[model samples]
Target: MKREILTLAFARAVSVEFIATLIFVFIGLGSALKWPSALPSILQISLAFGLAIGTMVQAFGHISGAHINPAVTIAFFVGNQISFLRTLFYVVAQLVGAIAGAGILYGVTPANTRGNLAINALNNNTSPGQALVVEMILTFQLAICIFASTDNRRSGGVGSPALSIGLSVALGHLIGIYFTGCSMNPARSFGPAVVMRRFSPAHWV
Candidate 1:
């Protein structure tokens, strides 16, 4: 008997994770990028990130559960909702997707307009400790929102998982952008940094 990991369904999920994360990063970072026309506002970036997430969730949630964020994948694994092997594969796929997305955006964007690939960085006034706390709190909320929206045991009370998850991501960015460029999802932070090869001291945050 073959394990579920080797099945077609598992392969499809992994592929979707890669594609979804790639598109998500491309759109999310593309929004924050400083264009020759005009710089993206915080609200613009927030909505872009949120919309990207919502679109992806609605598009792929059925196949891969749309755990676009590694934090969400790990959270599911930690809660015993997913197998460790599945979590590992999904995280790997997402990370690779993110890097590819950032790379593609970099290639398409003008050199002068490509400002640091909109990489996440700590604010001058913000210490690593402060950034860590902010990341934790914001990510925790996003994770909780994802969990609640995706839970199957609920008796039909949950409404619009995609919208709920997307809005939660936007809410995180509304404040997180000021501190750490709002990386509730580490893959979101990691993609541009790897592509740009520009890692700040507090890049982990």
Candidate 2:
């Protein structure tokens, strides 16, 4: 019975991670795709990424902690919030889900409107140094929020973790959007690049 429960837990965890990643990629990238000129505004796009994250956390928090972002997972792993094995599996699941999400978006949208799967890239105006600074700042804030909200021992359960995380994601996008479209998460960047085969210079390690 113990072995069975362990197996079940592992399955549930990966499934939760996969589904959350899928939702995150779908909503975030969907908003960035080319649409009718009258489509949603930039704020709306930011909010979509934020809200998708907020709700997904609530929906999958128990089974997987609903990371849905590789950067968040890596940070948590570094902080000892999750096991190394779990982190490895989480990253794999996230990448797979992200690719699946991008593929789905491609199939649903018009060929011309696919928008390169919303891959993040440094705009022409930004210097490489500026781009690096931008990503560091954006991800620093995001990591700080994740550490705070999910640190149950520290926060003692104050506000909603989902809300906090989503807000961080939106905040990063607000600033990083102009520079890098706010990757904040490597898996978010990876899947689209793999799908579109348009890896940018910044995408290289």
Candidate 3:
């Protein structure tokens, strides 16, 4: 009976991660699609990602912790919060979900407007080293925010972890977008790159 319960919980967690990641990538990338009539500003794009993530966290936090990003999953694992098997499952689910989200966006969007599904890339004049540093810093900030806001011991002091996390994401993108297209999440960068078949060597960094 204990084993069965654990299995059920695992399944629920995986399913929630997959679905939440899919929704996050879909809405976040969709916001960056380039329409001829109106292009989204940096602020708009940031808010879109922030709100999408916040909404998912609120919807799924109780069930699976809403770990829609592999980086977040790995962080939790490193902190000894999740088992190795669970971490592996979450990472695989996140990657698959990201690909599915990007694929769906490709299918539904007009070819001219898709814009490589918003794959992360370094802007001109930015060196690969610079981009890497920027990505690391951005992701670190986000990860720290997530840990602080979601920690149950500190949860009482925070009004909404979801909102705080979302704001952190938005803050990262608001600045990082200018340099590395703001890919704090590897799954977010990987999904669109896989769908578009556009891989930059720097992406692995």
Tens-place lDDT per residue, model 2, 80-160, is 777777888899999999998887888888887886778888888987788888898898898899778877677356598
Compared to the true structure, candidate 1 yields what TM-score?
0.97
What TM-score does candidate 3 get on C-alpha atoms? 0.96
RMSDs, each prediction? 1.2, 2.4, 1.9
- Over the stretch 162-182, how does candidate 1's per-residue lDDT look in tens digits? 999999999999999999888
Candidate 3 residue-wise lDDT, 87-170, digit = tens: 888999999999999999999999889987899888998999998889899999999999998877863577798999999999
lDDT of each: 0.94, 0.84, 0.91
Q: Give the Cα RMSD of candidate 3.
A: 1.9
Clash list (residue pairs), candidate 3: none
Off by over 4 Å in 3: 1-6
Model 1 scores a C-alpha lDDT of 0.94
- Predict model 3's lDDT versus the native: 0.91
lDDT at position 141, candidate 1 = 97
Between 2 and 3, whose TM-score is larger?
3
The regions of model 2 sitting more than 4 angstroms off are: 1-6, 155-157
